[model samples]
Target chain A: MNLQVELEHHRRVLIVRLRGELDHHTAEAVRTKMDEAIQRGRAEHLVLSLEDLTFMDSSGLGVILGRYKVIKSLGGKMVVCHVNPSVHRLFELSGLFKILAIYENERTALSELEVVS
Target chain B: MSEKLEQISDHDGNFMTLQFASRSENEAFARVAVAAFVTQLDPTMDELTDLKTVVSEAVTNCIIHGYDNDPNGVVTITARIEEEIVTITIEDKGNGIEDLELAKQPLYTSKPELERSGMGFTIMENFMDEFEVVSNLGSGTHIRMKKRIESKKALYN
Candidate 1:
């Protein structure tokens, strides 16, 4: 299946749930959507929920890294949750796990961010 | 010795080839085709996932780096299966890499402005049993990879 980006805003946090494949073919759309959402919503924190995501490549890592940089520059944080093993492998390969905190689920991510924000 | 060689040759050699334009839309198509072809070996979910990721990485490099995102450029993929081992080669007819070493370094993307993580080669190397690159300054790039599928059937045997 193609990629789908679903956004949920909670207070100043924006939760993006990605489904399907995220690759070079679909990364640009996801990047644009997330950037616009962050700006329009004035989101101070980002939570990426990948429970339904089936596939991701380095292009997906680039998108995640770019968004992390954006949020970091704004003095905010970005965390990812529900990452499948395949996607987690990419995160490890790219050294992204060093920078981005990972949670077990969306509720846990939101609660953790709540304590911080 | 002749009998041993004959037995080796008797092994099945299944293969498929694909050719498409260097367009972003075909990225998914290339990976999925390779994954589908690999199913004959009955790869586990993780192995299948790894194969798909490697295919995506190679195809992306062909489109973005080799062809410079030129739709007119052509990309080709050839996959061959011999017993439990799968070998895939992805090639592109575009401007070739000037420095293969730098290109393969993790987090060293030539097109940082495009938000490339420069993890393409790294991912391919990490996920596959064998990865090789052949490229010239103006001739284009060829990536060859091989992985032995340890299917449940193979394990049971």
Candidate 2:
């Protein structure tokens, strides 16, 4: 349950790295952490790194969708990177990839976020 | 009949059971539950993937809707095996679903503000051979799901 976030205000980009399981038990914590970063950092671009996410359920999806709406409302962009194959399938089945951009690595996602900003 | 939680033995090499507090705990347990129950069966990678996805859906529903997010509510998960079938039952005594049919409809979530896709039942149905939701307004919900194990030969044939 380690969620690390770094904010680059010049580009209005926020990078979030999630570790451990992202099921119902941990979704709320992740959501709160992301929300705090978004609100306090005033970031217009969001990039999530989920390489260490061992598990994710629909609650994880809810957290992602909720944040997506938040960023979209501010006319910002959101991207996810380093998603494991299992979690990637959930995103695919949920059609989340159609709405949110995904990258192969965090640096790529951050670079892309900067381009958008 | 007694409003008591029971731990039934895993019978027919089909199922196993675990009880936990609240929806969040149940969701976490669901992952471990599936892994342990299916381990002895020596399932293929694809089968493991399918079971994990279905377990997530079923356990999430038991916690969110069945237990109404009550942190103190209890969820009982029973996984059973028959010949070539794997059946899982998740039961919770919380606020029961009002309309089973309406609840099963895709994208119909009582907690829309939470961004729930309301596709839990839909996903479960799609991944399993059979899915059933039985509930009473004030009692609780029982989600029973079954999936037929596809033989290795079936993949090539």
Query: Taking the candidates in order, what DockQ does each have?
Result: 0.85, 0.49
Worst lDDT window (10 residues) for model 1 chain A?
Answer: A35-44
Each candidate's interface RMSD, rounded to one decimal?
A: 0.6, 2.0
Model 2 sits at an interface RMSD, in angstroms, of 2.0
lDDT per residue as tens, model 2, B60-144: 7777777667788887877777766778887888788887788888667888876787767777887778888888887888888
Report, for every candidate in turn, its global Cα lDDT versus the true structure: 0.91, 0.75
Docking category of candidate 2 = medium
- Find the 10 residues in a row with the least total lDDT in model 2 chain B: B1-10
Q: Which ranges of candidate 1 are over 4 A from the true structure?
A: B1-12, B152-156
Q: Write the per-residue lDDT of candidate 1 for residues A33-84, one digit (tens) a residue.
A: 9999988857899999999998899999999999999999989999999988
TM-score of 1: 0.94
Docking level of model 1: high
The candidate that wins on DockQ is 1
Error of 2 at B33 (Å): 2.4
Which residues of candidate 2, in runs, are more than 4 Å off? A1-11, B1-14, B151-157
Instruction: Give the winner by lDDT.
Output: 1
